[model samples]
Target: MRHITSALLLSGSLLSGSALAECQNTGNFQQWLNSFKHQATASGIPANLVNNALHNIQYDPSVIELDRSQNTVSQTFLQYAANKANSYRLTNGQRKMREDRPLFQRIERQFGVPAPVLTAYWALESDFGNVTGNVQTLRALATLAYDCRRGSFFHNELMHALRLIQRGDIKVPEMMGAWAGELGQLQFIPSSYNKHAVDYDGDGRRDLIHSRADALASAASLLRQYGWQSRQPWLVEVKVPVQMNWALARLGKKLPVAQWAKQGVTDVSGRPLRTSGNAALLLPMGRNGPAFLAYPNFDVMLRWNKSTVYSTSAAYLASRYAGAGQVRYGNAPIQVLSVAQVKQLQSKLRARGLRVTKIDGIIGEETRRAVRLVQQQMRLPADGYPDLTFFQKL
Candidate 1:
């Protein structure tokens, strides 16, 4: 018997089909899963459920590779927005919105989330249900849960996936999803689906994969649960005055839209955003790139996807779907930073007495704030985006 430790197992769950070939050390992986089955049963998961789900599950090394290869700081917001909300995606999303108008409206009446935003999320996450990945959810979860790097998190997700199966929400054999066990066309992880999925089509099951109604309603329910406000704009592209105050470029400070108008923030067409409520300014790329006034609903979308790129892109796509034009941006070449490079940048910011709470090589809020301070000192727009020039100057 080959005794295997999870520490030796790789991370990464199959988000893509290519991960099938990535699983190595099958003997050790099987041994680990076998041992984990006992633990799963001890934790109250039925022994039959554990055996049925884990017996035939294979280890996926591609999941681990993809997980470890994630460079959170690699893509700039502008790049992400452009790619995710490209012309093809936008056009397809608009068609999806039009075709599903009645359904969307009905969801809105019940959930208070706009159709455009929901459609945008669908388009971004799974390309409007065209490509929901070909990985088995159970296999991915089993491999990820056994992998030591993210064992606890994936273990919980695996248990949730098992419960979803046991509860008959979906069949065990037919459970396919992203590499990381995100089920259905919306790419929801198992726990999210269990919590937010709804049987909107009235077929008696919350089928996020084959049922558009279920997926959209589930997404809307999640937004509504996260406090989505009806008919509120998530974001609006704005033109900042050249001689503006740089201090206000900091994120998370919500001032009234009227105040932003007073500060000379105008829409792309040189008009006020014409919206109510307080908003925060987001310079996705530095000042040289586009700016937007993010509303509270933007925070709701942020909860949907924590990445600034994902949130901003979803908002941008939603705005377009709602008859808004493309955002105006200057042509600036963005440099992709490796994890090591970002870690070095974090260290430099720390050396300069700036507070970068985590030197994790991820450009998080604290890192962005520190970057803004550096830009303010250098008189370089204070947008907080660490572009090529900013990095070179530093």
Candidate 2:
């Protein structure tokens, strides 16, 4: 996670909307901290534990700044995939899988999640625990909980962070992680840690920060809880026909493998697509970029990280580790829209009675859906992706 900024707070841009009305801290930090201490103690957290963990925890403005500065609007799916699922990660992930073959086998047999998928998450989340983070988890959670924006959400996370300590899952000093208070190699939030962390090493403590076995097993456990299907395909690169109705190429529109094969979709080798069950045509960078058939397991991946780009990258990385070849970037350099351009397009889309929740310069799911609606109305390829041409037409 990135550091937070204080300038954005001065403009009130960081603390707007209903978040301001719900759990917004209007008083001093000390007062808020004291009140939170009482609440924590009341919630069954030991008074000493609460005090020790929260003592001298000044509000971290940088945490809030980093939270507000997060922007994935400028990154295309290919660029993100290239950065995240690069050669280095692939090599290291393969090596890790080979090194820990026995552990992985055990985890897969018990959790029903493949080793490659867990390795991909391990590689992507913290580079296999090389760089978990350095932020003081409690302080960051306290800061975010005190802030007006997302205060209530972080407040609950703070409670869970304290709960982790109370349960002896981790020591207060060891509670260091991302700015969002996500702990461990998997970068699980405190709530997730409480819910899914396991003591795979059988050392009596669920130590995710230093225990690879625990972290990997915990990751698999989390995926299983999110409805991962055993021995099912998560993602498969495919060649989509150029002449088909592009509207069908959407993440929400799932069709059976045989149905997609009938519609002219094939594996990357140009062979007919053959797989059990249904899959969605995932054109993350639009029709002019790489394509994949996302299965139900892919949806389970989304439950881990909602970003389509990140989920797709993780799934593709897993496939690569499992012996799939490089993704084929479609012919032509796909045009991308700038953040400002995306905001303008969202404004135009919202004006036309489309359901765009916010024009915050992010090409999120709603924005993509709105763009697809416009493209369909204009008789263009409705791939649910925004490009310069689509923006110009709008």
Query: How many residue pairs clash (N, CA or C atoms closer than 3 angstroms) in each of the candidate models, in the order given?
Result: 7, 5
Candidate 2 shows a clash count of: 5
Model 2: lDDT to the true structure:
0.83
Worst 10 residues of 2 by lDDT: 3-12
TM-score for all predictions?
0.85, 0.92
Q: How accurate is candidate 1 locally (lDDT)?
A: 0.76
Query: What's model 2's TM-score?
Result: 0.92
Which residue runs of candidate 1 sit more than 4 Å off their true CA positions?
1-28, 42-44, 330-344, 353-364, 377-381, 387-393
Q: Name the lDDT value of residue 359 in candidate 2.
A: 72
Please give, for residues 1-394, the per-residue lDDT of candidate 1 as tens digits: 1011111111223222122233333347777777878877887878997797766688887877665554343456666677777889888888888888999999999999988888987887778887777888788888788776667778888888888877778988779877777777787888878888899999988889899999999989888988898877888888877656656865688999888888888877787667879989887766667888888999887777665665677789899898888778743544657667887898899999998766666666778899888988998877677866788889
lDDT of each: 0.76, 0.83
The digit string of per-residue lDDT tens for model 2 on 181-291 reads 778888888877888899999999899999999999999998898899999999999998876778888888999888888888888889887786999998888888888
